[model samples]
Target chain A: MRAYGFRVPGGFHATHTYEAVEAAERIGYPVVMKIVSPDVVHKSDLGGVRLNISTAQGVRDAFDLMMLRINQRLPDARIEGIYVEKMVSKGLEIIIGMSRDPQFGPMLMFGLGGVFVEVMKDVTFYIAPITHDEAMQMLMSTRSYKMLVGARGQQGVDLKAIATGLQRISQLSTDFPQIAELDINPFIVGEFGTDPVAADVRMALQSPED
Target chain B: MLEPLLYPKTIAVVGASKKPGKVGHEILANLIKGGFTGKIIPVNPTADQVLDLPCYKSPVDCGESIDLSLIVVPNRAVVEAVKSSIKAGAGAIVVITAGFKEIGEEGAALEREVAEICVSHGVRLLGPNCLGLINTENRMNASFGGDIPMAGGVSVISQSGALCTAILDTAAGLNLGLAKLFSIGNKADVSEVDLLRVLGRDEQTKVIVGYLEDITSGDDFIKAATEASTIKPVIILKSGTTVAGLKAASSHTGVLAGADTAYGAAFMRSGVIRAENYEDLFDFATAFAIQPLPKGDRVLIITNAGGPGTMAADAVENAGMRVMSLDRNVATALKSKLPAAASVGNPIDVLGDADPDRYLAALEAAQEDDSVDAVIVILTPQAMTRPVETARAIVVGCQKGDKTVLASFMGGRGVLPGRDALAAAGLPQYYSPERAVAALKAMHDYAAWKRRPPRIVARFRVNTRRVERIITRCLRANRRQLG
Candidate 1:
C-alpha cells in the first residue's frame, strides 16, 4: 500500500523482545505494537494490540504480554511475530476499501468508519480505475460527506487525502486482480495537505478457481 | 455482424407447425400478416406445407441462403435445429425454445452446447429461451409474442419475454412507435451489450429502452451503455437482486458491497437512466423520443387549476429541479395577457375557467423566457375548460421554440380528448402533475450527464513488479487469502 502512495506508518516485524525494543527505538518513542498473524483478525479484541508505549522497557513488556495473552486465547493460531510502529496523531475516522465485483471487476467504496458504515450503510461505490473527479464525486455522494467537510463548525479533514487514498486503492485493486477484497479501517485524516495514515489494513485474495 | 439477425432478407422458421395457438404457427402467421418483403420459409419435418407455403423438412433441405433461422423446436431438438440451420448457411439464429438455464443444470449444459455450436460455426445466436425479435423497419415480426409494433424511433430490449409482451401491449395502447424489439432470453451469445451497440448505431432508433433483470457482464455493459447513451438516451428498468456473490464475503467491504450496489454505481457512471418501474420505462422513453432535451433545470408550470400547479411545483422541487419564478418583465407581460385572478408566480395559474387562449398566452411567455428550460401545462376538468382546444394551443405555442413542453390532463373521462390531442402532436402527456414532473426530471438528469466533460481516468505510478512477486509467493504457499 505504501508503494502505491498511501501514507502507511513506519512499521517492521519483530520476532523477539530485543528485536521489538530495537524496532521501537528505530521508529522513535510513543509507538504501538500489534500481533502479526494471518490466522488472527481483530487484534484489539484479542488483546493482541498495545498502544502509546513511550519507553523501550514498555515496548518490551507490551510485546511479551501481548504474545502471552494471544497464546493463551488462541492456542492453535500461528503467530508470525509482533509489529512495532510509530503511533499517528488523532484525526477523523474514515474507511476506504476495494472489493472485486463478480461482474464489474474492482469497485472502490467510501464511508465514515463507525456508525455510518456499520449501522447506517451510508456508503457509496465507484468502479476501480476512477479519476480524481470521480473519487471526489464518490466522497460527495455519501450521506456522511458533510462530516468529512466538518459538520456543526467542527474542523473538517483533508478531503483530497481521502480521495487520493481511494484512487490509490483503485489503482492497486486494478493492478493486482488476486487482491480480491481490502479494507483500510480508520484511515485517520487531518486538515488539507496533511498526510493521512492507513492505521489498519485487512485484505483477502481470490481463490485459484475463482 | 448482427445486421443479418436484425435485418435478415430471408428467414426460415425451423419448427413451423399447422395447429392453431402453437408457437410455430403463430410466428409464421405473424410474419405473413406483418407484410415482410423478404422470403419466409417454414421448415417442418412432419408437414409438407404450412400456411399455404411450401414447407421443407428442414432448413438444410430448403437449400436457401438463409440469413436468419427462428427455432421454436422442443428443448431436446433445439440443438439439432440450430445445427441444421447452420448447415443451411444461416447467418444468425434465434432459438425461442425455453427450458435452457432457467430449468436446471441439464438445460444449462444443453444451452451451452447450442451456443458452442453457433460459436464454432461463427454464427451469432439470439436466444435459447426467448420471445424472439422484431424489426419494424424491415416490416418483420419474427417472434411468437405478439403483433407487429408501429414503426418509429424507440427500440426496446427485454430480458423477460413476458415483460416484452406487456411493453408491446402498452406501446400499442399508447400509440408509441418502436423501431426494433429483442427479447434477449438466456443471452447465450448475443447479449444486451451486443444489442446496445447495434441500436446505438441504428439510424432509425432515437431512444433505446430495456427491461433487464440482470446484465451479462458489468464492465462490458458500462462500456456499451456509455457509448450508446452518448449517441442517444438509454432507459433501463432493472429489477431483482440476488445475493449469489456475497456468500463468500470475508471483509466488511465485501459485505457492504451488496448485490445491487455495484449495478447502481455502474448505471450512474454509464449515464444510463434507470427507470424505477414499468411505467417509468415507457414514460421516459416517450419523453426522450419526442421532447427536446432541456438546456437547463429551470422549469415553468402553466396550469388551469392552482392545486395541480402546486403539485407540479412540489414534484419538481422534490426531484432537485427548480420551479423557477419568471422574470419581472416576463411576469408583467404574462399578467397583462392573463386574467387579474391568475397568479403570475412560478406556477402561473391561469385559473379554473381558463380557456385555450389563456393557456396559449402563458405557454408563449414561458417559451420566450430565457430562464425557462421546460414547461409543464396542467389542466383539470371544469365547466368552462376546453380540453381539446387547450391541447391544440399548447402544441402551437411550443411549435416554434426548442423549449420542452409536457402536459398532465388530470381526469379519466373528461380529459381524454385533450390527452389525445397532445398525443397527436407528439407531446407526452401524463395522467398526473407529479408524473409529468418525474419525466421532466429524467430529461434534466440525462441532459446533465451528456453535458459533463469527457472522463479521463488517472493512472498512478505503482510498483507492479512487487505486487506480482507478493501474489505469487502467497499463492505458492497455498494461502489463497492474505491478511
Candidate 2:
C-alpha cells in the first residue's frame, strides 16, 4: 500500500531477534510490535499485537514471545516474522475504505473508527476517483464530521491529509478493478498541520469466479 | 440522424389486424388518425387489407424499402417478422409483442436472441414489450396509446409502457407539448442512454424528461447525461430505489452510503436534475419545458390571497430560496398604483377583490425589480375575481419579462379555466403554492448547476505493469470481477 504513495506508519519487517532490535533502533524507542502470519485473523486475541516497547531488549523479548505463542496455538501457521512500527497514540482514529458496487463500480467510504463506529455507525460514501470537493463532502456528510471539525475546545485533525488518503484509495480503486474490498481502519490523523497515517490496512481481492 | 427511427418516411405495420379491438388494429388506426402523411403498409398473412390499407404477406414481401417496422405479432412469429423487416431494409423495429423477457426464463432466452440479432444488424430497437413511440413533429403515432400531445419542445423517455401512456394522458390533459415520446420497455438493445444520446443532438428538444426505474449502465448514463445536460436541461424522475437494507458489515461508511447514493451521485456529477417524488417530475418538466432558467435565488410572490401568499413565502424559504423584499423604487411605484389596503412587501398581496389589472401591475413590478430572480403568482379564486382575464394578464406579464414566472392557481372549478389557459400558453402553473415554489427552486438549482465549475478528475501514478499482470491473470481465468 505504501508503494501506492499512501502514508503508512514508519515500519519494518523482522525475521530474527537481532533484526527486531535493529528495527527498534532504526524506528526509535516507544515502538509497536506485531506478529505477521498468514493464518492469524484475531491478532490481539491471539496475543499477536504488542504496543509501546521502549528498549531494544523489549523489542527482542516481544518478538520471541509472539513466535512462541504462534508455534503453540497454531502450529501450521506460517511464521512470516514480526512487524515493528512507530506508535502513534495522540491523534484521532478514522476509517477509510472501498468496495466495488455491482452497478456503480468502485465506491469510497469514510467515518470514525473504534467502538463508537459500531455503537453510532456514522459514515458517508462517494463513488471513487472522487474529486477534492467530493472528498470534502464525504467527510462533511458523516455524523462524526463534528469530530473532524473539532467540537468544543478540542483540536481538529488534518482533514486534507485524510481526504488525500481517501483520494489515493479512490485512484487505486479505479486503477485496479481486481481489488474487491479494502480498508484502512484506524488511520491515525494528526493535527491540522500534521500528516495523517494509514496505521493498518487490508485489501481483499475477489476470486476468479466472483 | 434519427431520421429512419424517429422521422421515418414510411412504416410497415407488421401483424396488422382487421379486428377492431386488437392491438395491431389500434396502432394502424392511430397512425392514420395521427395525420402521419408517410406511406403506411400493413403486413398480414391472412387479410388482404387492414383498416383500408393494402396488406402484404410479410415485411420481405412489401417490395418497397421499409423505413420502420411496427411488429405487433405474437411471441413465436416476432423473430421471423424482425428478420423479414431487416430483409426489407427496415432501419428500426418496434416489437410490441409481450411474453419476451416479461414471462420467465424461456422468454428471457427468446428476448436475448432477438436482442443479439438487432445488435448485429445495428437496428434501433425500442421494445419487446412496450407501447412503442410517438414523434409529434413527424406526426407519427406508432404506439397504440390514445393520448397524443401537442407538438412542442419537451422530449419524454419512459421505462414503463403503462406509465408512458399515463404520463402522455396527463400531459395532454394539462396541454403540455412533446417533441418525442418513447417507451423503451426492457431496453435490451437501446436503453435510456441511447435515447439521451439521440435527444442531445435534437434541435427541436429544449428539455429532456425521463421516467427511469433503473439505470442499465451507470457509467454510460453519466457520460450520455453529462453531454446532454451541457446543451439542454435533463430532468429525470427516477423511482424504485431499495433503501440501504444492507447492514454495516465492515464499516459505518457502508451504512451511510445507501442503495440510492450511486444514482444521486451520478445525477449530481452529470448535471441531471432529479425530481424527488412522482409528481415533482411533471412540475420540473413543466418548468424546464416552458419557462426560462431563473437568474438567481431571489423570489417575489404576488398573490390575491394573503394566506396562500404567506404559504408560498414559507415554501420559498424551505426550498433554500430567499423571498426578496421589494426594491424601494418598485415598492413606491406599486404603492401609488395599488389600493391602500394592499401589502407592497415580499408577499405582495393585491387583496381578494383584486382583478386582472392588479395582477398585471404586481407581476410587472416584480419583473422590473433588480433583486427578484423569479416570481410566483398565487391566486385563490375569489367571487369578484375574473380568472380568465387574470390568466391572460399573467401570460402577457410573462412575455414582457426576462425572469421566469411560476403560477399557483389554488382551488378547483372556479380557477380551472385560468389554469387551463395558463398551461396552454406554456406557463408552468401548479395547483398548490408549495408546488409553484418547488418549481421556482428547481429553476434556481438548475442555474446553480450551470454556474458550477467543471470538476477535474485527478490521475495518480501506480504500478501499471503489476496491475496489468494481475488483470491478465484474471482475464486468463475468465473473471471480470477479480479478488
For each candidate, give its TM-score against the true structure: 0.93, 0.85
Model 2 misses residue B400 by how many Å? Answer: 2.6
Q: Give the root-mean-square deviation of each candidate in angstroms.
A: 2.7, 4.5
Task: Give the true-contact fraction for every prediction, in order.
Answer: 0.74, 0.27
For candidate 1, list the clashing residue pairs, or say none.
none
Candidate 2 per-residue C-alpha lDDT over B1-483 given as tens digits, one digit per residue, 9 for 90 to 100: 456889888899999999988999999999999999799999998999878888999888877998999999999988999999988998999999998888999999999988888779988788889988999987999999884678988899998899888888888877788899899987878789989999999988989999998888878888999899988999998887623324333323444455677677678778899999768888988888888999888889899888998899899898878988789999999898899999999799899999899999998888888899899998898899888899999999998878889998999999999998898788899999999888878778778878877677677676767766765775676543211
Tens digits of per-residue lDDT, candidate 1, B1-483, equal 698898888899999999989999999999999999899999998999999999999888876789999999999999899999999899899999999999999999999999999999999999878998999998999988788999988999999999989989998877789999999999999999999999999999999999888888887899999999999999999888735355578777888887787888788889999999988998898899999999999999998887888899999988989889788898998899888889999799999999899988998888888999999989999999999999999999988688989889999999898888888778898999998989999999899989987788778888888878888887777666555
For the second chain, the TM-scores of the candidates in order are: 0.95, 0.93
lDDT of 2: 0.84
Off by over 4 Å in 1: A12-32, A50-69, A207-209, B60-63, B242-245, B479-483
Error (Å) of candidate 1 at residue B155 is: 0.8
TM-score of 1: 0.93
Looking at model 1 chain B, which ten-residue stretch has the lowest summed lDDT? B242-251
